[model samples]
Target: MSVTFNDFNLQTDLLEGIKSMGYKQATPIQAQAIPHILESKDLIACAQTGTGKTAAFLVPTLSRIAEGRFDFTSTLILVPTRELAKQIDDQVEGLSYFTGATSIAIYGGNNAQNWDQQKHALTSGADIIVATPGRLIAHMQMGYVKLDQLKYLILDEADKMLDMGFMDDLMKIINQLPKERQTLLFSATMPPKIREFARKILQQPEEISLSISKPAANIDQQIYLVYDQQKLKLLQHILKDVEVQTMILFTSRKSAVNEIVRALQKMGFEADGISSDRTQDERESILQRFRNKQLQVLVATDVMSRGIDVDNISHVLNFDVPQDAEDYVHRIGRTARAGTKGMAITFVNERDQERLVKIEKLIERELPKITLPEAIGESPVYDPAGNRAKFSRDKGGSGGGRGGNRSGGPRREGGSGSGDRNRSSKSRGERPAHVTAGAPATEQAPRVAGAPSTATGEAQKKKKRRKKPFKPKNAEGAGNSTPPAPAPAAE
Candidate 1:
């Protein structure tokens, strides 16, 4: 049975706000979870993205706020990322317009003015606060913020918060909250860890699980077996073949975002890239531009996969296969949202065959593979066992897909010579010397004989340099030390 907002017996003002937002009916999660929340029962609901879970908690909490009219802070919503914090803040603005409830979002950024605004809001006590765990801890560490009268504590995207290693911070904040407050824990999945965590905080919580590990049925999913060298061409082909109005292309590597965006721009597509490397203001600007249809292609790392909420995305392209199978779902979930049928295209290189298999298993269906165009040549055979072994043996040799190249975020782990991900191969523009010119088009095997001995050569060079016996032109000059250059911002 379908449930609409009119049946909830919400306060008239809150109902007006909902109508203004054009939300007449409640989603499944909303229908199941809102009643328990209205009764002040603790809740741990599992609903995937694009399922209106945010409003499920928000509507009831706002109704309580309207009914009680507490003077001090009444609600605190903790999220995993600054983007999500900002998103919830925006939603609260629209939903609370008629009710006159005040809220603010707090997140860490480089801007001094942002910090001041957050500090003021904390001291002044907004009725509701959307905050990231780390930034809220920073404010709570100072003595100005008061949550002793808080009536509701909501953890949005709770699983992602734990995955980002915020358990300690979460516990720290929870210990400071009132014991009698309502606690709502919302997540996209209900793994055992989440169940255990809920047992510690939630009190006989009502549970609702919907569409776990699943993308929408409207999505037209397709996979391409492509080699590293042929991915750029494949993407180009897809862009030319399809009519792409608005698309978000997800990559596993932050380092590769710029490269992919540049390639797309050079091919005459209006494209831009966003990552955590960008400042908070810059990331928001890019997202706004994409939402406004000013940008056709938005390239990003997985950081954008969860926090982004645009509904008109026509397609999603995975530049590189994700490290975790769950990420594949989130990435593609960006499309087929808001009742719109959409498309998802993934380029699976030889080294990522195992990852592709895991994605298939998680989704419980074999993704149809599109044949490679003749001009691009044959792709590596989909032989996960044989290719993984070749990659393992190549770790000891010299070539692309060799070992010891990983040094980045978690998504960079376990990726080996992924198409366009092998920055070494892409930069050098040539295979290693041991690799033959006419190697098999189906496999760029890391079959080199020996690894490069840069360590021994670097040791001899350092030995020769030897600090030059500490000789100095003058004793007075030696006492002065030069300051080092400022390092670049890390991703």
Candidate 2:
């Protein structure tokens, strides 16, 4: 059944904002949970990422407060990552822009002075406070914030918080809040522990579960069987096609993110890495570049995946398979957003077979296997010889390869005609006597069967000389050069 914002009793201001945002129909989660939320009832919504669950509660919660029917710190949303906290805050703020209700986000890794200023602004009190468990607990302990009157409590990505060992802190914060408050728990997947935790917090809450048996139906999923040594080569081959534009490449660890970023850079690709170890400013800079399309690829760990909400992502690559099945879902959720078709390619090696099977079982579908070019078999030269190669040759020397020599060093000069110096000399201008066409071609010093002779090198030089200097063409002329006209402006 199709439903719209009007189906729920929302404030005029919120309905207007929804209409302005061009959302006419409610997503499944929204349709099911909005009415109950509007009624101020406890609810547990289990829906996959990209299902619009954030809006499911934000709309109704904001609407209730906007109507002047709810009072005190009426809503508290706890997310696992700073990125997610900010994302939820943005969503609530956007929906309540015209409404007088205010929302603030609180998370670690930022100046306490900034948070102090935000808290003072909320002196009259914000309608909602979106925060991570640790920061919220800190505020509660310091008396910087209060939840005594908190009426609506939400645990977004509850399972993730638990996985991160935030349970004690979450319990501490929950204990401080009023026991009579309505609770809304939402997770993409609910493990047994999360279920038990939910049971303790929610009072006979309404349950909404969407099928998690497949990747988002709109996503095109494929896996490539690769040897550990050839993973980087396969990734390079896959990325060579122009079809992949914006991408999020997931790694299992912070170190893996650095490794992948180095590999991509060595291949002359613009990319960056984000992990828990990165300073807040560094992560923000990388994310901003990615959002602005200045960076084509973002290599990130599972922790960084939660907060990435960019809609232009066209591909998600599992460079290193995730340990948790649910994480695989979240990693791929970065792409195929807003009803657009996207692709997710996973590079699986022998060690990853078990984890890949677990992921397939969790998603209840087999990922289609993609064939690769024969050249992809070339082994990657990794730095440090150990059971688990900690770094790749492209990343250069030591310490897990974190920001090492990014130039990829020099290719070994061997194999007859394959030295960098030889290639450079050939690029400038030099010709051997081999290819004077009129002379018997065989008269040439017997060059290696398939090797390039000095004559071929001279041809390369001439080709380079004939190449035109790159100049920026006028937009009008460039537009005319394409067969199809440019797309119409976005609404």
Which candidate leads in TM-score? 1
Prediction-by-prediction clash tally = 1, 0
In the range 279-348, model 1's lDDT, one tens digit per residue, is: 7788899999999999999997765566788878899998778756777897788787768899999998
Work out how many backbone clashes candidate 1 has.
Answer: 1
Candidate 2 residue-wise lDDT at 111: 47
Worst 10 residues of 2 by lDDT: 424-433
Measured with C-alpha atoms, the lDDT of residue 412 in candidate 1 is 41
Clashes of 2: 0
Model 2: how far is 378 from its true place, Å?
8.6
TM-score of each: 0.80, 0.72
**Largest lDDT belongs to which candidate?**
1
Against the hidden true structure, what lDDT does model 2 obtain?
Answer: 0.69
RMSD of 1: 11.5
